[model samples]
Target: MEELTELVQKYSNFTQPMIDSLLTEIKNIQNNYSYRKFDVFIDVRNDYSHQAVVVYHKPPQVGVSLYQHKVVGKEALQENEPGVFHALETGLPSIGLLAETQENRLIHQRIYPIKFNDLVIGVTIVESDISNNILNSFRAKDTLERYNDVSATIQLFGRLDLAVTDQLVDSILVFDKLGNLVLANKTALELYKGLGYIGNIIGLDYNNLSLDGTNFKSILNHFLKVKVSKNLVEKKEFQYLDHYFTIRKLLNQENQQLIVLIQNVTEIKHKEAEIISKSVAIREVNHRVKNNLQSVISLLRIQQRRLESPELKQALNGSISRIMAIASTYELLAKQVSDDTNLASALNLLVSHFKQLNDTQNITVKSQIDSTIVIDSDRIVTISIIVNELLQNVVDHAFSHDQAGTIKLMGIIDHNIVTISVADDGSGFALDQVSTSSLGLTIIRSYVADKLKGKLKISSDSTGTTVAFSFNN
Candidate 1:
């Protein structure tokens, strides 16, 4: 106990007056206990000894206190007891039991470690009386056993607290009623190292945390005033190593800690701003393109009226229809503003346009389609062109002037494969009689086979001509 007091007195961070008062109380405690024949030795190194107090019977002097007694010698401390070794290694407490005769010869010895910070700091070596050896052994064992029990409990608490502390993402700055940092984690240590603060953050004042130029005083003031909060995110615009961050605050009332969660939002915020700017630019471009296409369609109508020959007029009409097909696809693209175009919707629009062109109330467009079928813009345009040609073929060849017939258009999409079929109940063609000279039929076959990387099947009987194609979705 005296050795512990002396070490505290020597290396303590407290004021000198506080150390003296603590030492006085320790001496009083020892005296009240009436401990005898015990020497309190603090061994920081094997060769060095600091004897603080010794209690003994047989009156070396009648009224002299343990601290006033002359210190005993070099040879007496030569035994490198395990208790002393443990104390030097761990900065905790320990005890050593020795049976030393009057002749200053050692007989038997046992070591007990006294732990602080889960480690041994110092030891008390008790020289037992020869007559009461058995009684003293039992007493010593019981004392050491209790000390171990208390020490282990403290060690476990320290370890558990340390583990939980390290897991916290926020940098915990703990304080008493008076602010101070009693404990810190690996993050706190690294932060200080980066700042070139060589001293440990554990014992520093909580309000004095020097993170760059931002101190903890104002944060501590706010914390003390308002202890509970839902969520407090403070954008401090703090800079570290030429980078900026917003300091986030989290208060854990259960543990009474003020946690600072530092976040860098500079890059993320900039990226969001850039995306907004680009979206505005793209929308404006699309609006201009839609207007320009409408103007071109008007100019084409003016040019079609001036044509002379009926064949030339028909060719110009076909060209007008083709341009209108592409224009309609873009119109849908502009309306949805989606990169993934609904291929089913686009095909339905194209079929409607072809039916209108033919002026055929006889032909009916039936859609058995998965509405959720999605294809890219380019693929949708290609599909639109193909559908237009197939429907035109049915309008021209499949129906007679006297007999009107119903034409069916079906689209089926399964997994990655898309199949579209145009079947008509009109004058059907023989396989040998089919020719590539029909402009609409030729365009449909070429697009389905070459561009789409798909196969086209044409089945014609007395009832109808059915053109079916399977392509990658």
Candidate 2:
């Protein structure tokens, strides 16, 4: 009694007379509340705004206490106990209202005002167990006791106490062993409302709300049938009403409760579809470009066949080879799904194709590139033209008639710099004496400087010719 007076004085804005009025009601509740088999308390408005503090507590002496421990000095929130605040502010009585206690338990409260000189001083609350409400619920008899035992454990694992779960973006639901939803967070309830559910979803059968039409019992059985560990979680995607969802389901082995988490993924699916549509369009464009280049090559071959002079025939062949080299890039792009080609494979393909088209008993083209690389179609087309010119120049000028020679293509990469070298074991010419007006020299220098954005290096000796170019990879 003395502590109750001190509590009112320390925390509330009550007058001395109001404190006495509250203590008088607390004394009557402490002595007579046991007959009702309920927990009783007195609450007064605190000096802080919109809160009340419990000043006295009395547990039933005849039966089990609904509260596990004393909570005399605990604050009562309006969200949890609106009835308690109603009695204190309006000097009226609020009866049979469901309220959540500070210990996270639910009970029915009956709050009555304590007043002095027509001014409300405090509220006296009598709280009883909610077993009668549970009796009317459809949740199985075994579910009630089992859910109580594991509800705290589930909240701990999810980091979702009731207060915090209301603010989460992910919808969370927990079901009992009987396939009934024992708990649902505020987000889940709102999600169901968006899905056209007009009523509360708690205590409802889970099959009614499942998007995939998989019953909860069958889901549990499927996990066992797959020989998966009971602790292993299963994740899947679902669509309902044009909304895409990624759902994860897990079963708590200790209590056999099922937990479901759902997230909307519609925007992600839309983006993926857009990317695939663009990829198909790109592949189509590359195919048409390859066909057009091949047609041009056919026309050049026809012109080469009509000519009798060796110089005219050789000139047409050079044009055809350059077109063919560029065509190879589009051909590769059309065959694969990705937009970029492997650099090593593209270079090797060029080497193999060129050797087959111009192979001779006196001339051999070999690839000695040891490093692996990948590049895009644009750069590969430029490289193809460059490498073909270098090889053609070696065939025409480096070796004399009836002379046997070998050409080796080497591609090396070091610290983001790639160097391609075409070395030929043929009679070489002097670099200073060579004509600047030479067509092959002009093509190589212009393409390397402008298209490839790289440096060109040439070396010649009495024994061999090596033409190399370097670019940033």
- Model 1: residue 308 alpha-carbon error in angstroms: 4.6
Q: Give the alpha carbon lDDT tens digit for every residue of 1-473 in model 2.
A: 98898888889767787877877787687678454587888888887655888989888877888888778888988667866765665455765556788898877778877878887778888888877555355335654564476767455466433333433477878888898777776678777666544234577666555755467778889866886554566788877534688887776656677778888787899898888888888889888998999999988888889999999998888888788878777778877777677777777777766666564559887886744676677788888889989988887888888899998888888998889999999988888999999777888999999999999999999899999999997
Clashing residue pairs in candidate 2 (N, C-alpha, C atoms within 3 angstroms): 343-373, 343-374
Candidate 2 runs further than 4 Å off: 1-168, 182-203, 220-232, 237-244, 252-256, 308-310, 356-361
**Cα TM-score of candidate 1:** 0.48
lDDT of 1 by residue, 1-473 (tens): 45444545444333455444444443543574343444333222222243222221122123333333343322233232323332333332322223333254443333333334343333334333333554354344444443356664344334333333343664444444344554454555565444333233454454334333444566666766876452443445555432345655545454555555444455776686677677556656656675676677678778878988878877766766776677667667766655678777887777676665556786566766678788887678788778777776777678887577877778888778988888888889888877759677778878888889888998998899898988987
Best by lDDT: 2
**For this target, which candidate reaches the highest TM-score against the unseen true structure?**
2
Each model's lDDT comes to 0.55, 0.77
Against the hidden reference, what TM-scores do the models get?
0.48, 0.59
The deviation in Å at residue 205 for candidate 1 is: 12
Model 1, residue 191: what's the lDDT? 54
Model 1 collision count: 6
